[model samples]
Target: MGLKIYNTLKREKEDFIPQNPPYVGMYVCGPTVYGNSHLGHARSYTSFDVIYRYLKYCGYKVRYVQNITDVGHLVGDADEGEDKISRQAALEKQEPVEIAYKYELSYFEDMRKLNILPPDISCRATGHIIEIISHVQALIEKGYAYVTDKGNVYFEVKKFASYGKLSGRNLDDTKSGERIDIATDKKAPEDFALWKSADGGHLMKWPSPWGDGYPGWHIECSVMSRKYIGDTLDIHGGGMDNIFPHHECEIAQSEALTEKPFVRYFIHNNMLTVNGSKMGKSLGNFIVLKDLFKKMNPMVLRFYILQSHYRSVLDFSDESMTAAGVGFERLRNSIFALKDVKIAENDDLTAYPELDALKKEFLDAMNDDFNTPIAISVLYEILKHSNNELNKADRDTAKLEAVKRMIFTFTEDILGFNWNMADNTDSGEENNREDKLIEFLIEIRKQYRTEKNFAMSDKIRDTLKDIGITLKDAPQGTTYTIS
Candidate 1:
């Protein structure tokens, strides 16, 4: 079956076929790079990372381009507050570009922690000034944009026949709904900016035909995507909140100039809400990911996001994270168990009805739009069977091995979530203070047991079990895990 994708532009699920065979072009709107990445940031990018990984794994060469909006992403999002990186730079008392470099490195590091491979090309808006200027110039020459006396280039939204097609709000309806704060001289209220003549106080202005100004927030993707991919891209993705003037203006400016579809399929992941409200800094509900890592495994955070469909709004909380942590451990343990156990010859298949059924169901769920939550539940079924078999001395070889591969491939490779078991890179990988200390104490407990200090051994074991990690005594040695 062909890959069925939910296109936000079409407002329906449709068959996904690329413009070219054996190669696909994908562009995802990356972080603004003004602040530290949070849990919600991870969910959106990691979600697309799985899609990028799976497409390449399916034998297609994919060029994944994600842009860093260093200069023009306004703090209030649409176009109100200060430049995000610039604002952060003020708080840190550093140059805006310095802030960009710091967080760009930090953002990729966090993504690497989750095992998300870096994109093929990482473009920055500030670096692509020429491309954006040329794009805005083309729009001007084609009669799709107008420049103000103050050197601001705004796209004429009323001139585009299909201005609101992507977001499903007709042009008339959008105009009525918005109390547009259009610069008094603009031709129309909904005419969003393509380039702005930066004021003297602006820290990150560039010289353009319009003046010494920066490109607007929406124009970055419009220019960068065309510079890297083309005017018409195969897949353009971002958070659902970006469907408005951000993406809509991009469509108007790009399509009005190029006379082609700006992006073929529009994909959006829903927002991350907290306490029944959307998570945002404005709402004062934002939690920094680096801060959260102090308390939880970052992999568990990724797993928690994957447990729901990408389109559904995921409400994050301690309770949900704790549940996801337990579930992820079960998956990790099943993978470990599979590596050690050898499969025996199964003479017949009918005996393992529940096991066989699970294998079929897991693939079926994955085949349908990569419904990972359903696929994860299918994994639990196999986890249940694997744990049952592990409890007993006898193991069915074929059934055991098959489920192991099924769980590993789907969960790790396809879903893009895995627990890191080996030594961390060039440093102690597991960063939680509590976890590292507990590991240290467990090592000492192992040594105590080795030295025949039964009294001290029991005390450490009892203490750790009460916290979370259970010390298991086996014939080979002692192993521990967080419950």
Candidate 2:
């Protein structure tokens, strides 16, 4: 079966077909670079990353574009309040540009840790002021937008009969659902800003048709997506929170200007919760990716996120993460063990129908709207069968090699797991030194146990455990697993 995508616009799974065959244009709403990346960022980006990888694996030339909101994203996420980056700048006593660049780097650093491939084009809002001004001008000329004497341009939501079509929120619904106070300059409460006049003290202002101002949060995506990837994108994705106001406004202004469909498929990933509560910095429950990486492998976090469907809410906690880590370790250990198995010079892969069936099931799950949870479950089934086959005395080396290739293809190539990092052996010389030190410590602990010094032996094991290493004592020797 061909790929099927759950289009949020249609509220159903539809066959995935790009506007142009063998070419796909995908745009995902990226983070506003005012703070460090968090669990929510990980879930959203990793979900898109898998989709990107699978598209390429299926022989599509995908041009992935992600935006960096360096300016004009208000604190209220609507037309009111200070820009998020500017607010952060004030609190930190830094320039707004400095704050945006700093956190933008931090965002990419965390993404790299998760093995998420970088987008083909990373556009910044501040860098595209020229195109934004042109877009706002077109909207005004088309009579869908109005400029205020206060130097603010707002989209006339009433002009677009299909203003809330993508979000399924009528103008009445929008007015009721709005959390932020509406700007007085807007003619209607449902109308959104296309461009905002920069205040006298605003640090990130640019010369626009109205005055010295910056583009609104919603307009940047519409302008950047159109500039980088035509007026109509094959796929547009983001977290579910963007359904209203942000994406709703984008649809209004974009279609009003282009007089054409904005996106073919609108895909949205569900939000992530922490300990059953909404994760927020204000709630004091926000989990940063860099902080979480210090506790466990980033790959483990990536693996944990993929255990749930993209359209499902992923409730995260220490317990759930620990369980995921154990499962990931099992799969990693089994796949890596095959490296030691010798491969037969000539072997037929079709000899094993069970392996072939498992592979097919894996593809089927992915084909059905990127169902990663089901796809990952199929990986476990493959692992179980491979273990059984490897246990037989007459196990076929060629079969073991096939298992290795299959696991690697799914886990690393498609799923985007970095095995070297997961195994805690990525750094060659440093890892070797660390391994030798761990062995030395294990040997010393063994001596302590041999002498019956229970206090020293237990202390050593507990110390290692505190540092995310668990010691397992087998009949032959002690082995450790790093979480």
Candidate 3:
């Protein structure tokens, strides 16, 4: 079956097809760079990273553009609030640009620690003021937006027929949900500002048609994506929380100007929750990514997210991370075990049913809209068969090599889990052997201590500790994690 995705715009699972055959353009709304990124931010980016990686794995030449909102994002997402970056700047006693730089670097560092590749181009709103003004002017010319008496610009949502199609919201009923105070300046209750006039203390003002002010948060994505990726794109993605005023306003302003479909596929990731409550900073329940890195490597956090589908809600908890740690260890350890086994080489091999079956299943799973959970399950299934084979103590070289290549290609290359324990240099082999030997020594030491042979146990641990191998015995078992 061909790949299919549940598009938020259509509200159905549609067949996947790029506007252009091999060249695909994807736009993901990036962090605002006002503060430290949290787990919800990680989920949105990592989910899109999966989509980006899998599309390239399928031989699509993809240009992924994720924008950085350095200005005009509000303190509260009510569409009428103080600029978030400016607020952060004031709190930190720094220029807005300084705050943007610090958080933007932190964001990329966290993403790298989590193995998320940076986008092909990261366009920031502050950098693209000219382009944003141009787009906003186009919207004004098209009559979809107009300049307010206070030098602010507002998009006329009622002028666009398909304003709420992406979010499936009724215009009349949107006052309570995702709505700000419909100020007297706006044409209607659903209307959102395309540009906010600069007050006297505003730090990040630009030269727009409407005097000196910053571009609206919604206009940033609309203008930057269009300038970088043309009038339309293959995919656009963000959190489900942005389905209304943010993305909806973007739609109205962009389509009104270009008269082309703004995006082919709209992808929205469900929120990451803590104890069944949304994990949002505004809600006072959020875990910063940097703090998470202090506890566990960010890759563990990424792995935890992948255990559940992107479209499904993932609850944040210690138990979930602990479980994900086990899954990651098992998955990587199995790859390591595969490399350690001895297998024969084969040239003319048309008779390996087990090996062929495993490869086919993995490819099939990954091809189906990048169903990574199923692909990971296939990894376990392959490992199960290989483990049974290993138990026989006679390695099938062809099968071993095939499975090794398959896992490395999908897990290491595509998923970015290099599984470095599967290396093949002499030093690497020696290191692996020493690791196993040290593990055996630790186990034997535990047994000796159990029998009250304290002297021998002490001697063994001392020798290992001197050689850079330390042991920690936990309630679960006596094992070693690299320092």
lDDT of each: 0.80, 0.90, 0.80
Q: After superposition, how far is residue 104 of candidate 2 from its true place, in Å?
A: 0.8
Lowest summed lDDT window (length 10), candidate 2:
425-434
Give the top-scoring candidate (TM-score): 2
Q: Compose the digit string of candidate 2's lDDT tens values, residues 1-483.
A: 899999998999999999997999999999999999999999999999999999999999999999999999998787877899999999999999999999999999899989999999999999999999999999899899999999999989899999888888888888785756878878998888889998746779999879999888999999999999998999999999998878888888788888899999999999999999999999999999877776677888899999999999999998998899788888888887776877777787668888999999999999999999999999989888668877898988878878888988999999999888877723434545677888998999999999999899999999999998899999989999878
List runs of model 1 lying over 4 Å from the truth. 79-81, 177-180, 343-360, 421-483
Query: When superposed on Cα atoms, how far off is each prediction in RMSD?
Result: 9.8, 9.8, 10.3
Clashing residue pairs in candidate 3, if any? Answer: 344-397
lDDT of 3 by residue, 316-414 (tens): 888888888888777766777787655455533446687678777777766665667777888898887667767676656666666777677888656
Compute the lDDT of residue 36 as modeled in candidate 2: 96
Off by over 4 Å in 3: 176-180, 282-284, 340-343, 347-350, 421-483
Backbone atom clashes (below 3 Å) for every candidate? 2, 0, 1
Alpha-carbon shift of residue 107 in model 1 (angstroms): 1.1
